[model samples]
Target chain A: MADEKIKSPKIQATEQMKQLITEYYIDAKTTKLPEGSHKPICWITSGGPVEFLIAADVIPIYPENHGAMCGAARIAPGLAEVAEKMGFSRDLCSYARADIGGALTESGAIPGGLPKPDFLLCCNNICGTVVKWYEELARIFDVPMFLFDTPFIHVEKPEHATEYVRQQCLELVKFLEERTGSGFSLERFAEVAMLSVEAVDLWKGVLATAESRPSPFTCFDAFIHMAPIVTLRGTQKVVDYYKLLKKEMEDRVAQGVGAVHDEKYRLIWDNIPIWYEMRNLGNLFAENRACLVADTYTTAWAVDIRIEDPLTSMADAYTKVYLNISIDIMLEQLVELMERYEADGLVMHSNRSCKPYSLGQYDLSRAVAERTGKPSLIIEADMTDSRVYSEAQTRERVEAFIESL
Target chain B: MPVAGVDIGSLTAKAVVLQGREVLSTSLTQTGHNSRVAGRRALDMALDRMGLDEGSLGFIVATGYGRTAADFAGERITEITCHARGANRTHPEARTVIDLGGQDSKAIAIDERGKVLDFVMNDKCSAGTGRFLEVMASALEVELDDLGSLSLESTSPASISSVCTVFAESEVVSRVAEGAPKVDIIAGIHQAIASRIYAMAARIPTNEALIITGGVARNIGVVRALEQKFDTRIVVPEMPQHMGALGAAIIAGEHHE
Candidate 1:
């Protein structure tokens, strides 16, 4: 007999969010045409300073987001193989491989691939791989590139490192002015930075709703809803979307609704999601009565961008991102999240494609357990590469972990 | 009322039948292509030994790689939990369990009541598992049962370095060609498995008294090597392969009430 699976009710805002993403992509794709918006398209890293581009009236494109799209669409492995055949090592980040392979093949989740970039923006705060990934893209498209270096924070963000990043923010402004053939506007940047802060605050508010018992949404929901926060952070559209998302979450919480049916355990997820397995993982957890109420990935965007001094605050906020900090600091943040979310346990993805995120996970797992007396399960798999994933093995581990909880 | 537990592993199927706290009978059989059939056969054999039939069982819990295939099971649980419960039952002092099964190996940390605290398993790799040793034994032209006793006779064990099963098999073949003693090669294979398991098992706290369970626990050479690596005496419960089935049976009894 086929078992009746108890699925979490679909969030009402998903269709609206999808439509918003479609419109964002359509707007980005049209900007490349001579008769279109005529706005210069800058391919930026997921952690790049997109607010500057917004202020400069240039359309920002995120290849990392596009890589995630391909992954969710289940076409990443095929695309990544193309790059592997082109002599790129399989050990390279799957995101880079998928994006590069999509560019060469002109096939992806989106037709005709992402519109060509007039310029490339690379940030090392996320990982060192993006530096080379963007360099390759710049060479391929024969475009100017901006490299923003954020030094790793061992204990705290040093004044010199912050100043160094702050100086780069200035140079980034000049770079934007030169590329767009327009003058830099501090007034415009200030307005964009304020909107960026407001959107991020709303995003945090949306995520915080998970603190309620029988959380309104899971981290899988957050991963989907986070698209606007990552892609269009400085715009009013992002602010409006998150406000709507937050309200829906509040209503769900007030109604005592949960993302998982009969939510028995609340888990905190660590690291980037396995994009291809998101739906399956979500269903598997929900079936076991575990709700992944929070995660470190989506909350990476929740960093406060103080608008008091736009450039300095941007420098500090971008430099001290979740990935760029020391393990000790990451642990503190993780422990805090566990307590705030009232998590029953933690699930960490030991992502093969991401070294910085995956490294020190074992230590962090041990530390978190010691601090919170909560068990942690580490699953080894690549974020975008399905080849590295073993379905039977992963299921067994997850089931066993849930049983332990 | 009698309760039963069926463990459908990749290589074997095991079943344990119990009434109250006492084990009535146990059975083991090779798991061929169809796991559901193997599960039923194992359970039936155990029941037949006790002169009881399927209807006699009050509850049936299933476990292992093919646990879900046993549709007759009242509950399906992972082999990790089963092994921990089984180990704790056999050796109540067991706080840590290293289960080396056919296709996978796992290190589990359990509480006083045998509830799992944390666990780590080999990631999609065949190294440090029973299958790895089976491949090496076949490559050495030695019987699987003789591998443990044969390795004990070697004074200087050959060094087999490859972690991949296929590569390690080739390494053993080359050692055989180079006139290395079969005993030494076999001993080296055990050492390699021990080292790989040690590296993974070290991630979790290895609180003694540590116990080894699963099909691989039947191999004395691997147990000795693990003892040397962990620097602790390891307990091997009687009928090590039946631990998961035994644990499932115990859980079945719990669920019956």
Candidate 2:
């Protein structure tokens, strides 16, 4: 049944993107081996500052990304159960549980699990769960951990808050220098920051291509193609990848091709993609002629970093992320995305795993509807955990939402 | 020409036959295990009542949870759209339609022309649905139909804190063990369902001229409880469970025309 419903047209770049992600994971897993680049492995959060590690010639590994891989492989439930049996609440972030379970059991989609981290770096900008999730990793691996605290932006990004994060960036530099027993050159950091900014710009351009009518690619494509921007940021490869992707999308748009056949409704998605059900959902929307053109999750990594003062700008950009901001600000951004994409409606994933992303979604949905007069549908499911997901319920709501539109 | 609509829900199947705007006949039956068979049976029963056969129907539309299983249906529409169309046909002034069915519940907002503007449904949980009341009825050893009348006798409704069906059933048992009146406990169960529905419905812009439909609408206790919660009069149509089927039949007639 799902096979027939999942016949959404695919983008040509998907094959290249899959190869890129596979190579990225293989490199991370083999970093410490004799045949691999003998670089130190540092486990970092998805929203953590990776340019610093990249500049220092350290391999930055994202357990959150690995959790997503586990989810996509349909092994997250078994991995999460290991943690659940160990007294971790089922309500904890599935990413954290899956990662911990993968680490403990040494079993996941990837062979030998993720390489042991020499150090752990976590940022609370994404969610508070990472603070404890990384701490647990630190305890399990007996490694040094750094918690780069970014204060929640309630109304505005205050100067002191930016300064606070700026000071931590400096501390992070020193921490890397002392931990690696090497001098952290400002010139090298600036170069990596430049590449990071360039990649972000290209990624933003890639996403903005969907602004064209009958968008060439849906957010499902973005969710899969966003690997490099999240994992390989501050590198020439990410910039090159986005250039290729952006051109493909532009060519598709010029050829009058749409992600969904005979696109009837365009929608903006909120929160994270349901990692496990991406194909099912993508196909479901395509079958309905509804294209999820824009989303807030992948767009979170498209930050604007100024090269004039790399440290200060990076601090400000990282401090003011999509998930770290207030609901009112989120509404404004969502409304902007809706207008930019000419969306007919909104779909919000009320993820049970990530509180920061899912909380206040109801209010945000209401505000978006009031501001843009567009209806929003909130589907409850975890980002990685499929146990909480009800396929029948989700299908009913999604079909009903599309019907209403 | 006559058109027919079949609604194969999780627990029951309903069918309605319509000629122009007037309802010719309606039938209800247990869905049992096979939705496809149940859907055919329902439509056949309604056709029997009207002294007609499948060949006489101009069009057939299927709806409800098991709409997809009805391969015999010429068209399949979701219950949300069907309920909105059904309620709007019955009460043209109604803008809000609340449907509490066997295993799920939904609150739909429709335009004056019976087009769905927005809707919200209870999540995978069965707390605010007819199944919850059925479980509570079995736990309290009372007939499901008599629950509404018995609850009306309660001077003070007992408090059911847990909204989960399993937990609430245990709460009902404990209340009974403590010698609390069954009427009060039943009233409390209705209030719990009302509150759950209210929280979900409040997410949308619920307007006045509200109509309640589905099997649970027969329970006056829940209807009155919802009326008090929304602080508005809720019109329960004569054949609440048949609304989805009737709406499908109306849509079928329109399609045929």
Candidate 3:
């Protein structure tokens, strides 16, 4: 530390972001209501990872989902700047920066800023970052962090990995039991799983509504609407909220209330939302009546694959998502979303923030576009950093491609 | 009689207020916080530079990601339409246009008069886009203005493989650790950027006078690197960043009865 001139990028938003996150912490901490046991909370990776958590009398909060929202809100830039100011390289994903920055800044201060986690769980099937992120979080909070180590079995649904994940879910129950002084009940767990499954089924129906010719709702809306699910997924309140959303979407479809007016060409989107750009892009699509019928990111919450339902069913599904698997699974999901949405084209954002999501997307674009006789538009941009967006270039490409489609 | 164009790009908003064939004013400004505010401010600056106001214009067309958001705009044209229009106006023989903007990159193959034929765009990553260039340029402590020139000083350019911006930051750290020449690494960054653009250009047999537009056109190093990659001198229009907006304005002019 002897006069080392740090060659870090100039992070202009660092102090302000730290202040904002600290504010969120203060807001979340100062207002504490009477603790309710049934309102038990758990945070996990995806819509699936929380199933066991939900089934175990715990409300599920998806930190990764929240992380994406922070990126989308364009707040991640400031947080990343803060992280950089702390000597972390700009090389880490902004999500990691924002999360760590916000947590460090809060130090027990905002409404839900680093909420005291009763328990944390992950399938670790998605990214190597999950383990490190959770481990670090667990270390800081002194909370129980359960890791479901699923083997990297590309396609084969091997039993060992499933068993490993299942054991982790049991461990999660034990971990929760230690805090609440309650034992695991198999019957109660199954009931909770069925309820979780039912909630997801309704969510899938809502997503399916996008397939309508006019597209009742855009993926942008879905991204916001999915917030309740992430914050309260295991709760009956979440299930009730989605039921209402699904019915409204149904009514829209029946009455022909399209999210986009004069729906002409429907398209499917692959990869993450341009977080800071969903509104502009959504409006652009609406201008042309080209509904973004489905998105890979939003659709994940609605994934209801036919997996065996027992103690381990939810665990396996949670860990076996496209984020955790190879490109083949992603490609398959693309095709499925395309066909289900009845899209005339596909728009793939080759996002710079996440490589695993963007990997081989070109091939997926080509294959899906040519094989299905649907055109594809691939636009490149960062998820959070506005510096990465070329508004003119993107508009040009999107307009040209969409006009053709 | 004069026609003007404005390209309200993500990184910077540029205004090219042309009085007939004579260029009256060209203004460039950072998009800062709000694109709407930036677009309006850029137009006002350009108009002020020309000793005119918004009402003095025959018509106005807005283009770019912020085009639809332009309230003063009488009409909105897609960046594709504007880029080609701007390029064709600058170089009549131009058949292809590549616009590397702040967040994304695109290649448009156009006809003689600036109608798009086949096009490819990369919208997913920051690798080849302005953000990537800015990040790498910052790491090298080379001003955006000097990156292109610095690369020229390189004897042998190194390679950058990470398409993700975050990954590339680490990659740059490794390059520095290996003691690679800063100039060559800078040159390699330009090449990494060029390769991403070239992939889009290769989607079809791009026509001659391959005009490069958008904010990236300001990067002389990227322009030079692209020229080398394609084995041809790439065409860059005067006030290249404003091409999209100018194309929009031109379209607006044409649409006026």
Candidate 4:
């Protein structure tokens, strides 16, 4: 028994996606005017309107993604320490701390730091912290900063809210045009919007394949492969990549091959992942023959986007994101996900870095338990900072939850 | 067939042997630095007392923080599930369990069949745990066993605002410097732990039939404080620390089927 081997089946597409992301970064890093480059680089939030930026031929960069890389490399806390020493509150979001620390220190997991942003994009749809986080970057860099404010959705999407967000989408185009010294092209935007829509649809298809009994791929695989959808969503490459991923998942489902060797209980995860402990968590659940089939975090990439009237739809889509809604809406979504996936339980990550996501999880967990008659486990930890994690405590909670199931 | 259960906790290792529904023997020892050594020693002691060898046992189960480290048991289960099972086997009507171990505290809600329905645990901290009491005992220059009774003598317990063990120690030092009565300070520490546990326990749908288990349950001061805070009578088992091992043995007996 001691010699028994436990192996989590590797997703075949990750190796190719890793190479693809590396090349994409190298291209963004090496781009310069010396080589007759005219594309402007803009540092955007993860939930920013990247399709419009892509349509205007501007390169978009997500610092939050870089923060995840720093976490994986285990340099996030050291980098956050730099920012904290500079008087930034340790209570600030770790992603914000890591990004601010990386900017000031000009060093990170990637050599020479991220390419200097020609402009900045801020969206409050994800969290209010980004408003201050981006303001600091703008203060230091002295660049044009655009703020897209999407009010929280409480009961329903009011007409005034949609109108307000639609106006900002138009103003956003004008802001980008003025900064880049170019005019917005309707034809170009139509192509990019359609590609973005197709990419999102493919991503939805990829996640839906997990509804199979022994999921073809776990959410851990989705967390890694989700980069292209976040970074390259409005491009043809993203559409092509997801098509390949969806086909592979289809084959796995047909072959009855699961992410874990023996899949017993299927669980749905809420909130962002513990990036530093992904492999550890994956192995932990896999060892118990429990597969995390779906999660709320990665589903943000597939928010309903209408291509017919892309700008107006963008207004509603970006405003109604999971984090920007009320607990009632979140509970509704949780119930839908639970039924759709037939999950045995839910695991809520009470992330220290994300207040908006973690604030109402207790209520949400209770609601989920009542609605689905399934257990939900709340494990406290930070997404990027390993310092907040207690392995022994988390292990006991997870083991007991699995044993009860 | 006789079955054995071993619980290797952070601070103690306990073993229990059962023949049918009767507990044949039980043993407890400090876990020391090596949990596997402590586990073997405790289990051997219990088996020796019962005049039984390893070959006589039908199955063995392990539980607690050091459970996986033992590597000798046929199966491992978490203390949360085991505590509920063990409490149910003894009380038969226990719907809730509050377990305050050496390093962590948890509240488990169980159904009629001893199946865990819901639960909540303290954030990874020593607050509201046995370790917290030990630190306060040393800081106040009192014995760990005497802390409970000392607190009982105080009419006005000095207020302890800090729930963190480290901060609470410094607070105790400052109080001692201010010449506050030692009995009052000890009572305050128990109140703080009881309040913390009560708040965590409130998260689950608790019932009147509640059982408090683990090594800390032997502290009457904590039990009294919890009774005051929760306004409910608390039940303490005869061998509180052995519940996890006893539950595991109960499970081992069932494994034969």
Could you give candidate 1's per-residue lDDT for residues A361-391 as a string of tens digits? 9999989989999989899998889999998
Better of 1 and 3 by lDDT: 1
lDDT of 4: 0.91
Runs with alpha carbons beyond 4 Å of true place in candidate 1: A1-5, A32-37
Per-residue error for B33 in candidate 3, Å, reads 15
Considering summed lDDT, which 10 consecutive residues are worst modelled in model 2 chain A? A1-10
Lowest lDDT sum, 10 consecutive residues, model 3 chain B, at B1-10
The fraction of reference interface contacts (C-alpha pairs within 8 A across chains A and B) present in each candidate is 0.91, 0.68, 0.32, 0.86
Candidate 2, superposed: residue stretches over 4 Å from native: A1-6, A33-37
Q: Estimate, for each residue in B72-180, the C-alpha lDDT of model 2 and write its tens digit.
A: 8898888899999999999999999999999999999899988998888988899988898899999999999999999999999999999999999999999999999
Q: lDDT by residue for model 3 over A1-405, one digit each (tens)?
A: 111121112223234334433443344344344773344555566534565555555645556555666767667777667768978766555566677776666521123465556667765666666777777667766777777776665887778878887787677777777755667777776665666667778888888887777777777777767665544454565566667778878888798877666678888877778878877787667666577788888766664534346566666677676687767777787887788777888888887767777878877877786568776787878777566677656766777787555
Q: Residues B88-158, candidate 3, lDDT per residue (tens digit)?
A: 88888988888888877878878887887667767556678888888887887778778878888988998
Global CA lDDT computed for model 3: 0.72
Which ranges of candidate 4 are over 4 A from the true structure?
A: A1-6, A34-38
Worst 10 residues of 4 chain A by lDDT: A1-10
For model 2, how does the per-residue alpha-carbon lDDT over A180-298 read when each residue is reduced to its tens digit?
A: 87899899989999999999998998898899888889998898899889998998877888888888888888998788878889999998889999988988888788999999999
The true-versus-predicted C-alpha distance at residue A254 of model 4, in Å, is 1.0
Please give the lDDT score for candidate 1.
0.92
User: What does candidate 4's lDDT look like per residue over B1-257, in tens digits?
Assistant: 89999999999999999988899999999999999999998899999998899899999999999998877899999999999989988988889999999888999999888899989999978999999999999998899999989999999999999999899999999989989899999999999999999999998899888889999998999999998888889899999999999999999899965
TM-score, cand. 2: 0.97
